[model samples]
Every structure is written in structure tokens, then in C-alpha cells.
Target: MIETIVFDIGETITRDDRYWASWADWLGVPRHTLSALVGAVVAQGLDNAEAIRLVRPGIDVASEYRAREAAGRGEQLDESDLYDDVRPALTALRKAGVRVVVAGNQTARMGDLMRDLDLPADVVLTSGEWGVAKPQPEFFARVLEVAQAAPEATLYVGDHPANDIFPAKAAGLRTAHIRRGPWGHLWADDPEVVAAADWRVESLTQLARIVSA
Candidate 1:
């Protein structure tokens, strides 16, 4: 039985509309342009942040992030950013005695913002806090450490195939490929993703039921 369920933040628990839109405004480019570029990079298996670099070559993204914060426009997260199934599904899992954790590739500030939202998770962590990002063996090692459970007893859920499904599976956790965002939809039917994911779900509600059973 699965004792712990770890989630990816972007496109898994939350919609990334505001994130890309904010970057578009900051870069003075049309939102659709950046969105298209993000999708392009995601398809090509490049980092999504490459979209920003495409617009401004040699730009220091971290510096720009600080600049945006200094100008009073940084990362923002609230109720609307969450998927409709997030609260109910996570709450249900926790109530059912399943350990729920939210760990994703996000900044330290984003982790604080996530905590402020008070989602029903036992732990909320970000890559920025752990100093390691996904697809890395160290990141999954940290997750297993926090979980305090055998890898086979934990499940990792996310929308990205390369970052979420593949590595998590390699770490011995059962993997669920959630279909929602650009990468989710684009790679949902890919042979590798389908083969790697132990479960393929469209929504967290479906995931909740799968776990409960």
C-alpha cells in the first residue's frame, strides 16, 4: 500500500497561467508569444525557462527575479491558482491516513507562498529550499528521507514526464502522470511516458480514488 504521496507543484497542483503571464509582462512580450515558446521548449525537452532566455539572451534570470520583486511584482499564488481538485483530493488523502507532501521545482519565495495558502499537506518544500531540483538523484533522496518510508511505499505525482515521471520511477516510487498542463497534454500519449507511469490520471480526484482503493 502507498503510505506517502508526493506532488509536483506546477501544472500538478496549480495552474501556471499567472506565472507565464507575469513573465510576458515583465519581458514586454505578448503572453501568447511566451506561452508558445514555453510549449516549444517543453516539446523539445528543454527547460521551460529557456523561453525567457530566448527573448533576452544572456539574461540573468535570478537577477531579473530579484528586480521584479524590487519593483513589487514577483511570484504570486492564491486560491485561484490551485486546481479545482487540489484541496478536496489532498484533504481526502490526508483524512484517509495517507501522508501527503507537496514538493516541487519552485523558488524559496514560492514555497513560502504555498505555505501561506494552507493547503492540506504534511510538508511543503521547494527545490530552492532543498538546493536540488527534479530529475536529480539527490532530490529524490531528500524526498525519501522526508517521507520516512520505503520508496515502494511512496507515490510521486506530476505532469512533466522527464522531470516528474521518469526520475521518480527510477527512484523506486510508483509514478502517476497527471494530464493537465502543456507538457502533460503533449506527452500524455507518448510511449515512454505511458510506459513509465504506473498510473495515468487526468485529475487529482481520480488519483484520490485510485489511492483509496
Candidate 2:
């Protein structure tokens, strides 16, 4: 039985489009331009950082972060940032005796933000907390450790085919590709990749139905 579920937070449970708009605002570009740029990056399997740099030449990624820190202007994650289906799906899973876990490539600050939001999950973890990031084997290993879960009995849900589905499958967990995120939508036509997923859902609510079925 799949009693444990490890979820990638961004674009999976979190509504990240707002942040994409925030980035466009910061870069002084129309929101749709950044949206199309991100779609192109994912479609080409290119690094999104490079796309950002191209959009804003002379962008000092680190320096910009420090400037934002100095300004105390960080994009905050709150309940408002969650997808419409997140709570309902998590509640359904929890009521079914499943242990839901948030495991993702996120900054350490995200851990606290999630905690403050009181998500309907048993435990929350992040790349910064684990000192590792996904697509890296160690990150999944650590999540399994914390959950005390057998990989085969765990379901890993995320939005990226490369970063989430492929890596989780390699780690021996069932993989679910959520169809809403950039990479998931852009990469959906790759039969080789999509065929490998144990499950796919248009929305988290659909995930609830899948799990129940």
C-alpha cells in the first residue's frame, strides 16, 4: 500500500504563476513575455537561469538576491499561494491514513513559510534543509529516511518530468506527473518520458481520485 507521499511543492501544490509575474515586473517585461520565455526554455530543455539572464542582461543573480534582502522585499509564500486543489487533496490523503510530505528543491526559508501556513501534511522538508537538491539521489534518500518509507510504497508527485518524475522513478518510488506545470505541459508530448510515469493528473483533485482508485 502506498502510505507515504512525497510532493514537490513548487508548481505542484503551490500556484507559482504569481511569482513568474513578479519576476516579469522586476525585469520590466510584460508577464506574457516571461511566460513564453519560460515555456520555450522548458520546451528546449534549457536552463531557466540562462533565459532570465538573456531577458535581463547584466543580471547579477546573487547580487540581485542580496539587494532584495537588503530591501527586505522577499516574495512570500502563504496560503494564498497554494493551488485550489492542494488543501482538498491533502485533506483527502490525510483522512485516508496517508502520510503526506513536502519534499522539494527550495530555500531554507521555505520550510518556515510552509510551517507557518500549516499545510495538511505530516512533515515538510526542502533541499536547503537536506543540503541536497532533487535529480540528486541523496535528496530522495533523505526524504525516505525521514518518512521511514519503502520507496516502492511511496508516491512522489511533482510537475517536472526531468527533475521530478525521472529522478523519483530512479529512486524506486512511484512517479506522478502533474500536467499543470511548465515542464510537465511542455514535455508531455515526449512519449518516452510520459510512458514512464506511474500516474498523471490534470489537477491535485484528480490525484485524490487516482489514489483512492
Candidate 3:
């Protein structure tokens, strides 16, 4: 039985299309360009930092959008909406005795985004706050400790294979791949990642089904 469900915010719980579209517009590149680049970065098995490093020199990282995010003054664009049914679905899960935790690579400052969306998770975890990035066993371990869940009893759902699936599996948590949000289509070659996941859910609703059932 899955006693807890830990979520990643950006591309997992929230749709990142607006943010990426804004980023693409600011960078003067096509939206798919951002998608393709991120796909390649993840496929290369680079962690978030290394992938950002590799992509930075190729693009202007100090542009207005990223500048705002860096300064902690960035306001989310339209891409920050919760999945259409995610909140109510999660609410149902909470009612069903599953604890929910938010784990992501954001900053505590990102609490603003969650607040704005009126989504209050039971507990929030971020790489910025934890000083660790995903695909690292310690990251998931920290979340597990906070949720008081055994690794096998927790289900981690996120969009990135390396960040979400890899480390969660490494840490002994069941994993779910959110297959409808940003960077969703990039995990094509190594289908095994999603294939091996406990659930390959196309939307949050599907995930709720897996969790609540």
C-alpha cells in the first residue's frame, strides 16, 4: 500500500507551458527548442546543475525572465496553473489516508507560486532549501524522513526521468511518471524508465486513480 505520495511542482503538478513559452519568447527561440534542449540534457544523464551549465553558455541565461527568477522576484506566467483536477484529486487522496508532500527543485520563495495557486501541500521540499538536487538518493531520503514514510510505501511522481524516477527508484520508492506536462515527450528512447515506473500516468487524474484505488 502506498501511504504517501510526494510530488514535484514545476512540470509535475503545475503545467510549465506558460513559463517555457515565456522563456522561449524572451530567448527568441521556438518553444520546441526549449523542449528539445531539455530532452537532450536529460538524456545525457546530466544532473540539473550540469544540464543548466551545458545549456547556459549556449543561451543568454541572464535574460529578463531568468534574471527575475534569480533575483527571486519572478512572477509566474500562465504556465503555473495546477492540473485541472490535481488539487481536488489530491484532496481526495488525503481523505483516503495518503499523505501528500511537495518535493521539487524550487526555492522557499517558490512558496509564493503555491500560495498564489492556493495549493498548500502537507510539507514542501526543495533543492534550494535542501542543498541537494534530484536523482540523488539523499534528496528523496530527506522527503521520506519528513513524510515519515518507508521508501517502499511512498510514491514519487514527477516529469523528469533522472530527477524523479531515477533517484526515487534508487531510494526504494515506487515512482510515477507524469506524461502530459513539460518535457514529457523527451523520455522516448529509454522507454524503460517509464515502463518500469509503478504507474505511467498521462495526467494527474490518472495518478489520483492509481493512488486512491
Per-residue lDDT of model 3, residues 94-173, tens digit only? 87788888888776666555655556367766777788867677888788887788888899888887778877888888
Where does candidate 2 stray beyond 4 Å?
A: none
Against the reference, the lDDT scores of all candidates come to: 0.94, 0.82, 0.71
Among all candidates shown, the one with the greatest TM-score: 1
Q: What CA RMSD would candidate 3 show?
A: 3.6
Instruction: State model 3's lDDT.
Output: 0.71
Q: List the residue pairs that clash in candidate 2.
A: none
* Candidate 3 wrongly placed segments (more than 4 Å): 25-66, 69-73, 77-80
> By the TM-score metric, which is better: model 1 or model 2?
1
Worst 10 residues of 2 by lDDT: 65-74
Model 2, clash count?
0
**Ranking under TM-score, best-scoring first?**
1, 2, 3
Structure candidate 1, residue pairs in collision: none
**After TM-score superposition, what is the CA distance of residue 159 in candidate 3 from its true location, in Å?**
1.5
Per-model TM values vs. the true structure: 0.98, 0.92, 0.78
Q: Write one digit per residue (lDDT tens) for candidate 1, span 148-194.
A: 77999999999998899999999999999998999999999999999
84, model 3: CA deviation in Å? 1.1
Candidate 2's residue-wise lDDT over 1-213, tens digit each?
A: 787888898889887777678778777899999888887777788866666777988898768756665777656787789988889998999898888999898778878888889989999988988889988999889878876789988999988877888888998998888887787777666786678789877877766666677
